[model samples]
Target: MNKQIIDHLFEFWEQIGKHGNFLTKENGFSFAKPTNGSWPNKVFDLTMEKLDIHALCEEIISEELPNSIAVPENEAIKDLLRSKGLRATSKIKAMTLDTTNIFFGNIDASEFIKVGSPTEAELFAQVATESFGYPVDPSTIGALVDKPGFQIFLGNHENAFPSCGMVYLDQNGVSGIHMIGTKAGYRGLGLGKKMTQFLVNQSIENQSKEVYLVASQAGERIYTKMGFTTHGVLESYSLSLH
Candidate 1:
């Protein structure tokens, strides 16, 4: 498979896979997306050889993930890319682990989950702003909330509302812990550590093969304590949507 297409597919997956509609327009382009959740990270790999863009698009939509919309702009580019033979795919890997000798406590996630949506991108963003301290807009958070495997665990109190952490399940049967944080007042009580383990245990209960995540430098040690082993790293590249 094309690495570029796979990378785009992984981005789409990370964004909830609903964004597939965005790539269907004539000007929009993608290489490969996931079919039914196997190796979800594979969706982000870019192959070296360039295939017929239009034919590739058709093949991707027709075979890989057929939910693609029918738009004039997408059709035109499909034809053009097919002629150019410049196929792009992203390179990435899947992470996994076995559920043996794991240490964690009950998730108790639903206790703090007051507002739950199948995929509430708006609220997800609001909670992230307070949790991450970076004032992220809904548009940016919406992309993540829409991804295939996204779940939010939050804790709220008077004058303080923070998202405890976020977890997702990929097509590869590996669960991922994206971001985990607690409000200033809620720190030092082990909330951050527990939430991380909660998601890991949850994945194991669901029969997931492994759990993976791109952790911040400081957060790496937290995952390490929870029986998570790090073998390698994953990086991101963009082509300037402008």
Candidate 2:
């Protein structure tokens, strides 16, 4: 599960880089332009080998959370990041759920959800921005629609598209659920959970054996109730100088 967690992240970025015009990837690092600054651009795959901290620090252009790196949860590693003038901004749980182990008592997430369409990238971005209070470029999600191995969905309620989520099925049949969000006005209605369930259901339908995500504190409870177990922790770091 740990290896899958790391590989899925790298592959997910690879898919995004393949279609995002303003995004670039090299080795385990990826970047988004300032215009698409709110996009999740970061460094990952640190467990495979030796890390070149000096070169990595040079690539960091800001101290913001968006300009972050995904690193293993280790005291020594975190101390090293801080020694290089970086700060630990977030500690998130890396969770995993085997599809066969799920037990959704009665929460039916079968609400109407539109499969991602290439023409609706702007719509996806619109819902995402409204939900997150951040600017998410259309291309940030648009380039992913109609893409293979990725199943994106828009949740509809009361004739409004206020929620969206995606499931990325990696080559090893590991599904990663990401970007599950509902607009501020539409939250507290269990829409977020529904979107997550919808993504998980899609993974089961596609024959993905395991599902994973790095959950925020709020999302951790929801996903845990959905049968996901915390496998480990992942910390995000950003250079102090920018």
Candidate 3:
């Protein structure tokens, strides 16, 4: 529950969330980053001069996405890419956002979930695998927590076992969620719902007007039930270096 950890985790999620694989040079800065494939080709002209950003984008798309992907481009962009000896392909990044009705009713703050310290690596890994659909190693999850501003919250049942659903709070006024699953063999219970409501209430209390996350297919319904409308999807892509 350290404020510093909460701030750092938020910053890290922002940098990697919108930019995906692009490296950040500045510190303590946040911006409304353009999602994948939404950039104007002129951005390439400006960004590619020093960074092989276009190539990196291409590589990311090929490696991560192979179906229904097209990186948008204009004739000028095509020429620019061709001149650089790189071929161009157009693609779309699914982006969704809703601001009209984004709030969930307040719940009892006393019933809040308990957030453990940064050392709970195994617990973090389990959530990552089940909720986020990521095969994160325990060490990797721990390292992420070890980062300066990563704050994670865990929900427990009678202090015996984790009920699944951990919230990652960041400093960017955006709270992200991961590992939000009901415990195996405990499905159909309302544990997942309560945990989500707790986090949303907490995020709003912290002054975050909007919540964002990359939801899995199965978990999308849960988020929708919690009043989080789809903001948009960034079609992920990855290409080989060869």
Candidate 4:
């Protein structure tokens, strides 16, 4: 796995901490309580090399009540977790945009709106929830309004708020697309692709050397058409309480 992709994912979760509670220790154990029924409310970076896997799993089970554990795919860790009774529940691809040659369908720049205030941020969150079928804390979106290098864009189709996208640019010149979505009724309207292109263009304007994202299965094709190639796989494991 590319280190930049890994770091960007970690940074994405770290920014989620701004809205609620997030903890990352030097030992590499980290967790966030985004309270949005989102992936941020789980454990991350759990490599057995950094901590005792059994003890860590037990601790998360007892104290953290972790909904999942996300880590770069590793056969050793996967086998060990399976041996310990955990199973991978899902997998998402980590992809990087080919910044040198980006291509997206034509979209009028006027169709998208920049999310700059709390009210607009909340609207963006609502669109995300409607699109992804998961709760997104509006407070979390609002919190990013003032965060440096975090930008959110919302798309309006037929006078309705139907799509939203976010981009995070770290000081290290790595930019990541996050939480991009279009409402169920808005699918096939090219809103998502437009929002993505808007964010990518913004990142390029910010002088980002790399742009990446963890793409959902449904979103893989959209990104693929935009010249994003799979760089790695991130496996998500769920602990069976029973």
TM-score (all chains, Cα) for each model: 0.55, 0.85, 0.53, 0.89
Tens digit per residue, CA lDDT, model 1, 1-242: 12222232354344543543222212233332333422121223223244334454445454543323111113344344445442322223323345666646555654456225534545655666566665544444444543456665665444345545666665655566655677665778676766667767766766666566555556656666666555444433222112
Local accuracy by lDDT, each model: 0.48, 0.74, 0.44, 0.77
Residue 14 C-alpha lDDT in model 4: 75
Better of 3 and 4 by lDDT: 4
Better of 1 and 4 by TM-score: 4
Candidate 3 lDDT trough over 10 residues, lowest sum? 37-46
Task: State in Å the error of residue 139, model 4.
Answer: 1.1
- The stretch of ten residues in a row with the least summed lDDT in candidate 1 is 37-46
How high is the lDDT of residue 20 in model 4? 50
Off by over 4 Å in 4: 24-26, 36-39, 101-105
Tens digits of per-residue lDDT, candidate 3, 1-242, equal 22222233335445433333332232222222222422110121122335454554554456431222222223443455456455533332221223335455654545444444445656755654565443545544444443433445556555634454444456555555544565664557676677666666655655655544556556667666655555433322223346
The TM-score between candidate 2 and the true structure equals 0.85
> Which portions of model 3 show Cα errors greater than 4 Å?
1-11, 14-115, 130-133, 144-149, 164-172, 240-242
TM-score of 3: 0.53
Q: Which candidate is the best by lDDT?
A: 4
